[model samples]
Target: MRIAFIILLTLFYSCRGVSQSFEGAWKGDLAVPTGSLPLHFSLQKGDTWTGTMRSPSQTRLDFKLNVIEVAGDSIHLQSAALGMSYKGRISADGEHVEGTFRQGNYTAPLRLGRYDSTQTVKRPQEPVAPFPYNVKEVTFENTASEVTLAGTLTQPKAPGKYPALILVSGSGPQNRNSELEGHKPFEVLADYLTRQGVVVLRYDDRGVAQSTGNFLQSNIGDFSRDALAGLRFLKAQATVDSTRVGMIGHSEGGLISLLLAGQHAPDLKFIVSLAGPSLPIDSLMVLQLYHVGKSQGMSEKQLAKVRPINRKNFEVVKSDLPAPKAMTQLLENMKSVGGASGTLRKELQVMLLEPYRYFMRIDPVPFIQKINIPLYAAFGEKDVQVPAKENQESLVANLAGNPQSRIKTYANLNHLLQPAKTGGLQEYYTIETTIDPTLLKDIADWIKGL
Candidate 1:
């Protein structure tokens, strides 16, 4: 598994004795759906004013753009990476700036005040070690489309064929390492499992890493084909014990794993889920938005509006209407409620629009129940990404009569199987560690038992 490269550009600005119009540090806050978050805009004069802007406490939010754009009292910054944009006016003192934050279908008026840049600067975490395994980077064709897939095969270092397991990544355009927030869970897991005498195979999702395909164009069903192809690759490997082969999926990967086991059931021995969603994804996302809004203290009346507006935007995508038009209508509904007290309209708006089209149609029950393989599911109680209760409840409810299925719940762990403090997104960025060793242990024990 290869780690993704970090793009860090150090931009230099010219300082003049005669002095330029806009220079020095600019501090402010951007209003979000939940509340206002601090934004640090460090500007230096040259051809253009530029500097990196970070959120308060260095919240690991995906900003639209880190570069600062200054035009006299008017400041314009856009983060294409995060699909967010900001436009505001800087105070005459250059110490404060107030503007509107725009993301997809939502917009909010944001205010910011000047602050010292010397305040404690928090650094990011170290990358995790790759799972102990003999590795091979390979590429092959997608028989259906004849498109080549880039992937890595991590096997036990010792000789002799071993039970092989295919690793499936979670949501988003993930590479072979399953990199997220500077953590490479696939490498960590590959290393852990291989050392324990299991041969593992993990590949890049199409359109990510060296693989080929359009991520935005593909849906969950398309991803399942990729997983099956990976499995096929493993079965063809001379060093793998095909009879004992299985699948391990995390988050979205877990859902895919169930699909593979259910439909193909291709000599698969077992399956494992790490923090995967078992409920309908739309419902889960609604719960996420509601939880986030409540965490920021939205009142009952405000929440009432939040739910339906959220549901309409999310559910409408699955309707007969076109996705783009459905999304547009959803945004309008959100704007109608944006003025409500304590509601983060822009955040909800953006949140509702992008992920809605991808997740609204995903229902994992059909796949989960149809799977003939022995299933093992694990979730961290503190996980906010996939609510612990929702994941466990739905998985259990689906497998209620299936005695062969096993489920375990871990307390104080986050989505990545790391020990967590309430498992909030902030902790994911601030706290540094690969994953909890205990999680690895649980996985190994379960596999061995199976």
Candidate 2:
């Protein structure tokens, strides 16, 4: 998921004064490689000009720009939580901002003009009203955490008890539909699968959308409990077959499904890992960063330099030594690569926090190897994050003796499983199709086989 996307910080800023023409709102499109991300910034000129940023494509509808510093006509706004920063100059007329938006190693051109109401993107794949199935908004409580998880449950209209499948969303705080860019793949998948006679339960991640919880404080075990709670809810329903309840997880959700299979093997009949990481997250992250960086046109030299730094950072988190000792080693490693700055140092500490630390240290292979339930895992050939070849190989090797496991990879598909020319994250929004038909068929066919 994105540690950068949801870093919340309470910064105290002194209102310098509302003396400039830069007051009010300015809105524009940040042209990323996949599609345009509509960004709305409301610059309130005060003692220290404050601003809030809104990206219609993102889950957080309104976000306080963690750091926005203005020096004369020069403007600098940053959201360290999102690994995003903007540096530009306000036009002489104070009606425009021309700048570059940077996230990690990715950068895109952004131009803002007079503030306009947030615009909506067309998502044809999103399931509309009058769904063919019986769709209802439901909520269930995770007894251990006492957190309410809200979700949509869709059962075939026939009313007979049917096989149930819980849809677990991937990284980041996603709504019921696992929405990203302009696509609602989970909704589309739910609609299709439900129509094919399966009950589908898709829900928002804890602390996301209608759910309640602190995502920052949650880790894999916390999420595993949520998935298990959803499974319990689905199994207890009269419309679902308790004996045939299964889970289909995408990306991180896939890993969660495996965890469920390992911990709640009796309750979970089967699982599907769609582009799920089979290796330790740290290993997967390096490959992901490299692929994404390469797609963004990062030169080989730059990649070579940064990749090692990132790998070392992960190693620091995974080291078995004492926490302070590990951190000292990490700083030394960072200095050797000229990356030991205050920001990077602080970022390293955040990485050691629960979420990042879990990803770095947790290895799913053992859980997967212990999984006794049937498992169906598939990967997109063109996927950059959690690439197909290596992940598939690991999964296959780990499940060597499990005949119930099915692993396959599809060509020309990106992480989202849409037929993509280039499997870059930037291409996510531009593609019209939510998920490729073949991917759907692969899942449906496997489920039918069970």
> What overall lDDT goes with each candidate model?
0.64, 0.75
Alpha-carbon TM-score of each model against the true structure: 0.72, 0.79
With a 3 Å backbone cut-off (N, CA, C), the pairs that clash in candidate 2 are 4-81, 4-82, 15-47, 15-48, 16-47, 16-48, 17-46, 17-47, 34-426
Please state the error at residue 429 of candidate 1 in Å: 1.3
Worst 10 residues of 1 by lDDT: 1-10
Least accurate 10 contiguous residues by lDDT in model 2: 5-14
Best by lDDT: 2
Pairs that collide in candidate 1 are: 28-112, 29-112, 33-344, 64-79, 65-79, 131-191, 132-191
Per-residue lDDT over 1-450 for candidate 1, one digit per residue giving the tens place of the 0 to 100 score: 000000000001111122124455655444332123345555565775555555432234434346566655676777666577778766555555556777676565565655565655332223245545567899866777555678777777667878789898876666787765456778778877877888888777776657888664566677777777777888888888777788899887887777676675666778888887788866776776665454445566666665775666557655656645664665566565433222233333433333334556768788777766678888988776677887798788776344566788898887777787766655654556667788788788777666
- lDDT value, residue 261 of candidate 1: 69
Candidate 2, residues 297-353: lDDT per residue as tens digits? 777877787777678777877767666887788788766555444333544555555
